[model samples]
Target: MPMRRLRPRPALPSRRKAAATVVAAALVGGAFVGILSLTGTPHAPSARAAEGTGAGEHVRAKALPADAHGKSGKPGRPVRGVRPPVSVVQIVAHPDDDLFFMNPDVSQSLHSGNPLTGVYLTAGESDGVNARPRDAKAAAPDKAGYAEARQNGIRAAYAEMATGSRTSPWDRSAIPTKGGGWAELDTLRARPQIRLVWLQLREAGSVNGDRPYSLHGLWNGRIGVLASQRAAGTPVPTDFAYTKEQVVATLTGILERFRPTFVRMQDPSPGTYPKTGRFRDHQDHLYGARFVQSALARYAELPGHPHVGVQNYLGYPTSVLPHTLDPETADAKLRTVKTYAWLDGVHDCGTDAGCGDLKVAARPGGRGWTQTVRYARGTSTSWVQRDRDGGLHAFSVLDGRLAAWRKPADAVAWRGPELLPGGGLDSGVTSVTLPDGRIAVFGTRTTLGDSATDYRREVVTTVQDEPGGGFGPWLSLGTPEPDDASGTSDISAPAVTVAPDGLATVVLRDSRHRLTAREQRTDGDWDPWRPLGGTDVYGDPVAATDAEGRGYVFASTPKTVLAWAAQSPGEPLAGPAATGLPPTTLALSASAAPDGEGVRLWFRKPASGDLRSADFSGTGPVSPVTELPGTGVAGYGPVSGGDGLVAVRSRTGFLATAPHGRSGSRPVWTLEKFLFSGAPDAGTDGVAAIGLDARLHWTPAGR
Candidate 1:
């Protein structure tokens, strides 16, 4: 295809002006950022802005009566109900990374008609061979041509997703990056809301091999400035090199320009086998994600940008895990890949370099990528809690800090997602309510230091000093692994449960896939970390308390679920007994049974979205599993249950819910068509989720 004429660079808008315009548009439209109904309608903002404080202001918690039930008396500063418009910015290592790992999501966001931008860090010119080995007539190695072909494929795929046709034209232009380089920018003409940015940096030829000039080398300080590889027929006029600081600055520039409400990237710490010393994902994916992480840290420090929620997607490692998508969803995902791979081998795109990456034509799906989508972090379902006064409080990590949202028992609308004070908190936050009604929130925090080796992750928690009161300072709970190098900071999000005596126990799966925990003493001191005896454990562990006040914890392996239950109230947990269950999709949730018989464990069957549950009274054998009637909306993730209600992610990437105990009868699932981060949390009066727009959305009971 002939390259489109480059458009003149437009004057950039100031950050403050841009931010104000977004907020005004959203408020005038009566909708929160990034939220859309099933019919693509925007829901009205549920609450008016607080009178005195700004929307992002921090509200000081006031103390309530010791025995108060969910009442916070009078709100200090209500959370700002009006939020800025929502936009998404995704950064990946290569052209097809978003399609392989972040899709269904990418496609769904496009359907929502929100502003979405994808940024590619490198020119994926691998071996310069655009065809499979069997195609002898394929052209000789032309790195520039291969890169251009890949770009064409990506454009076609995204166009088909945004508009209805793959032939939709795009407006091509060049933009100056903060990293002191020029990047090619393509905007879909049919739907101006969608865009693609190409940095055109050099990619490592080998996936796992030692490439001294690659992103991995630069990240590890083995190289200075990595040179760029401009694609053939690109709009960029000249090539450039980027040092570590420059690369981060470039990404930070993109974030500032877009001011996205949600940011997506690959997993920085995909983990490695200690014995084999093999990384779980491609080196470029890992190192590139690290650069994005650093850029996000820098972006968070700058003012005027909207608060953003971060989601890290699992990359190549999803191949080894069981398929998370059903046939229908998987097939849809495969169709997009086929378009990107130019599987039909048609030259319809008019590109002499070939329409797409023909090398992927032989296996368009690429391992098991198209069949599954898994999150590397932020899968915790314990983020929502009911306080003593029967009010609801929901928590999520936004801009590397704890964001709290509350709904009073007497109020019709929710309030305050007012962010807490500190930062560096990672995704996947969990919480537990103490006997006295105080709630404690837990999460892992990433500490980035001067050197790459200084990167570290450790558990930290903050608790309300009294019911409905201000939270105390964050307390650090050191990691079980000795350091970041050994563990790659691959610890699971903390699963905590408060005992009847008011003590708390935090459980987590260590880097070696073993369960370890710490117990709180009467004097408010914590016990040293101790192993809980389990191997091959994967995913985050869950903790729950039964009617008898006993605490139960469960973690899943590829084959079965393992359990660790307290022998008595206020005591250490016992054996990691086998649950004798079948393989699961690695997502687990727990809640007390309605009958008060035992702690009920909820999970999905392997390769299917069917929900199943079994009651565990103690460490003894669990009750026979019971399958819930399918809502016909297949999805993979933890299911949150409370007050006889359950909330799950539906196949359409929306929140779906059904009441518990409708066995034999098909329950009507109330589906909400908004894409959200982390897991949905269910409470007595409502279901809550953190929307991609970085705001908390609550669905009242019976809605």
Candidate 2:
């Protein structure tokens, strides 16, 4: 027996008249055009949804709020530099998940002035109840309306971040998603640089070992036994008919269009819940993550698809774990901890859409909101490369400059010979091969006076060429002269990237810390530094050039790996384009390698304790690429350079590689450890390993 279908909603008086007029005209024009649209075009609805497009008949009409737009219709700011070579696309199960977990990267990309997009899989509708602050006039604010509340909350949050105003109005329009569901999307909030893609699927209840039935169990095929019952009086409908493939297709369609360079999703593992032996994370979060993994597999098979970087964020159960933040910016974010935790007035109202959903007001004295720290604060790390032969050099403040290693098979493995420069190695040291083949290193330095507070700011550069690759001397590059000193004060280490033009551009994240660029002439002449007007990125920034000779910058804060590029030559780089990053304590290191006709970014994710790669091939953003695990802390070369095959040291002393421009699961080469520079010898064969003696083992490609 065929299942009975629901009746279609009656058209409004005016719409009915309009349809009649259209039908009359169509009849006069004949059936050819009608047949084409009905059978071949995307305009045709599926047989089951022929009448109402799957959302069902009598669709509830919620007057969408005003469309949010900046004066121009574009979202966000225009990227100043040549368009970025790497694209990034971030995907998450719910709205605000990126901000809460993959942020700094998301925010960083917007500032990178690059093309980026965010895709939310679910409407993130929680309990549907919008809670109000206790101090409000109305004690019991409302009983139900969680979905609307979440919508309001997310829109407010997005509007605030995009347009620089939380009060920005949103114009909502229903866009049909795969499986016939409708997504009410928000239009431009900031500038048009950023776009919000929402697939308004229902949210699953958190399985805190409490809920008997949930969306998680239903999606996994447990059906009635593990599913939540529907509310009797609610008009909002629920369906458990979607298959795993249908859900993946919904996401796949979004990816096909965006082609992001990065995709951030919640941790699928959800780790183990401390209190309950079961997975601590909500079942939805886990399943959603697995669904994403499936989509990635499909995406990887697509021709000309962008290289995507995937970042897994810690979830609710892992919230209590130690985490890290951009040292300099941690305080500013910490200020909002109270607001995120408590039911403050800030999250109370939804000026445009009503209160947003997702999270509910915390119970009295409950575990309030808190920032997750990945690593200990103020732990400084750097990637030092030998200019002599482009070998890898890594330095950390782990035990102060006392830890220095050199590459040599004879040296003892894993043992450090602290090479404390007479004046202490400056913070943020990066290596660059000079036109003359000499290795140049740059970092920030401060001159101490008699008093602890007495100090002067300065930028310093050094040169090294030899077996030990010891620095020759420090040449002062003058002060960046920043405007703010909230707590810490020091000019950032200059970010150096040898452009395709052979001219070296030294960029710095300044004290008030704007990004400034200076060029080192191939003739050895230095240009006066100029401000690039992007947000201050808080870590060691790396730069690379695309096939078109466009300059790009890749940097890391405690939260993300960000890329910047100019729209064209002589223009400032775009605001930061995000590397879909999770909150990690990774001392990030990045290098660009040839990708077919362009360049791709090979990065190390310290948080995951492995090396990974991604490329930007589209106009939107990069996609997430699965990391090839094996290399450990020793296998890492935190700072890596070279093309074709690249080299990086893992903390565990193993070297690994993902062939240039290739995707899918492939085996990686793990090089044997030989003590060289307290680490492994960096290589160009795309393989290198680190040892205790600092001596690096290098293997030429194919040799």
Candidate 3:
């Protein structure tokens, strides 16, 4: 989230980073989504006024059918009681951080049905008065009162987004944190699913300033105990202090209680001006996100905890990149920001954080920069999948829609670029082969409402009309957490495969970031959505079928990999059972293990991003993870074939390949001149990726 600049304060001496582990970066985008539903879940269905009644009024969702043009248009059945299962916890340094950095997503998730929890690390006691300087000259600053008012404004905005009313009453209470201090927690009265937690700690007075007693000081070893800047209306008896370890422990405790599938915070790696050497984001934002990252590691290691994904947003500098959000999505984001600012001259919150930031409320649409969002380190793996006939079928999101291409076993060059129909699809899609040889293209569709803010992301698929021809119209498999579209960014790209009975099974990360699956029956109808029981899964899922035709789906957490296997065709999937492997990049590749009873998983190790592998044979234990000895390998692969063909990137970002298959083998990876993004498709034909120039580049395995 961007830091709202306060009045010109004295510039304090700049201190260097506190620790070497701090991921000081401009962008490190890893795909994570939060599901929103039609109810109080992150995605609210309508703008119904909050009556403060415990029973929330439901907004019926509109169903869009295909028009004559084969695109979304005609009205189908409206999905009611469609509650999404995902939850989101947003950690920011101040009140407006989410608005400035993570909206559109925030608005979308809330509209979809993912429950939300926002944690504000500081009280944001900026100059303390709710009024402007010109009007507050005669009044003393009320830090406590001002903080309360700001929180009230936040409650109003959150209520409106989740329940369509700013006056949604909140049950506020004090909760004890592991840090040995009391933090304020608020729950929505009508929609008990939404929550807010306030740490109410002191804010730094200046940008790039170092304090011996603030979050920065604690992070850097300059402070032993930091005192609280309690919100006056909070239900704590006495003010308390927190040590550095205590603070980390306390955030960790909050995470344990929430068990959030998705976690978001401001940029942890906020570098400084190149020439001036000044920090980019606020000291609190950088340090606060770092603490959260540290807490996440601890949380992930806990025995019995669910898998959780983390998304670190870009700070101020994102403005310079190309506008990533659609115009409608961007507009919806600003509207929410305006709501938080209370820009419509509304005073519904009644308490002091003084409705909202009047300064920003007066100018809700800040410079065009606020409309843009970008992520760092996005490695887009290819969507190329090989079918039984040895023909290649590939899918990509072209011009905001799903596009298809084919290469026949008897043909030389790839076939026509057949554009399939699906709207609001993310940048990529996945495809799988059926037992009959026809290919099925699967994707997460984004259905947009009249207002961009109202959106939905659902699992969708379409089969090839003829063996090597264009695909049929899109089929809506529907989301388990069918939301009104407050948000659905948490949904992952699909990992699909076919069962022995010719049934098509598609697996993907649900709105809740869990592994979920749906299968097409003999009648060509899809089964209802259900969880495969894995957590913290990210990006595109990877699936492989053993010799028995039992399908194995693998999902990568920030630190570990989990697999769910199919018992039989037309039967429920089981076993998100742990693979007992160490952490990997959110990306991974899986192929049937040579033993025919298990699967081989390939991924890059964290910290070094070195390509590594372990064999899972559905036996007693997985083999010890062995490093695929190589230097300068920055990412994992589009791993394919029983004889694995791996893709790797150099430390300098050039892409290349390495072979790893035979037992006890240590093949070396050499850097090539090709500059590629996404995974390289490796098969009997070759490896392919979108080059730096944005064109698909193909390299034969012989090279």
Which candidate number maximizes lDDT? 1
Root-mean-square deviation (CA) per prediction: 13.6, 28.0, 22.8
What is the Cα-based TM-score of model 1? Answer: 0.87
Best by TM-score: 1
Q: TM-scores across all candidates?
A: 0.87, 0.41, 0.47
Query: Over the stretch 528-584, how does candidate 1's per-residue lDDT look in tens digits?
Result: 999998898888888765444556677888787777766545778765766666778
lDDT of 1: 0.74
lDDT (0 to 1) per candidate:
0.74, 0.42, 0.56
| Cα lDDT, model 1, residue 456 | 85
Ranking of candidates on TM-score, top first = 1, 3, 2
* Candidate 1 backbone overlaps, count: 10
Per-residue C-alpha lDDT of model 3 across residues 477-569, encoded as one tens digit per residue:
877665432222345667765666767677777645677778777797877766777665555677655444555566767666676655543
lDDT of 2 at 477: 70
Task: Give me the overall lDDT of model 3.
Answer: 0.56
Candidate 3 residues lying further than 4 Å off, grouped into runs, are 1-382, 387-390, 410-412, 415-418, 484-489, 593-598, 617-621, 624-630, 635-644, 668-672
- 1-703 in candidate 2: lDDT tens per residue? 1222111222111100001010111111101011000011111211221111000110111111010111111112221111113344666766556555554434445554445667766655554444444434443333234445555555555555555665677665655556444444456644555666666555664654444234454444454332112222222355333454566676776777766544556654433322344665566675576567556656655655533434445455434432433223333333322233233555445343344432334432123112332211111222434434333343332111222333332321212223445343332345555434455556555443333234344666666554345566567677556321221242455666554344667787654435777776657677777776545344445564433334567565645555566443334455455555443333443333332322343444432434454443323223343434433332222434334444443322233332333443233443332221222223342233321111112343453
What order do candidates take by lDDT, descending? 1, 3, 2
Error of 1 at 520 (Å): 2.2
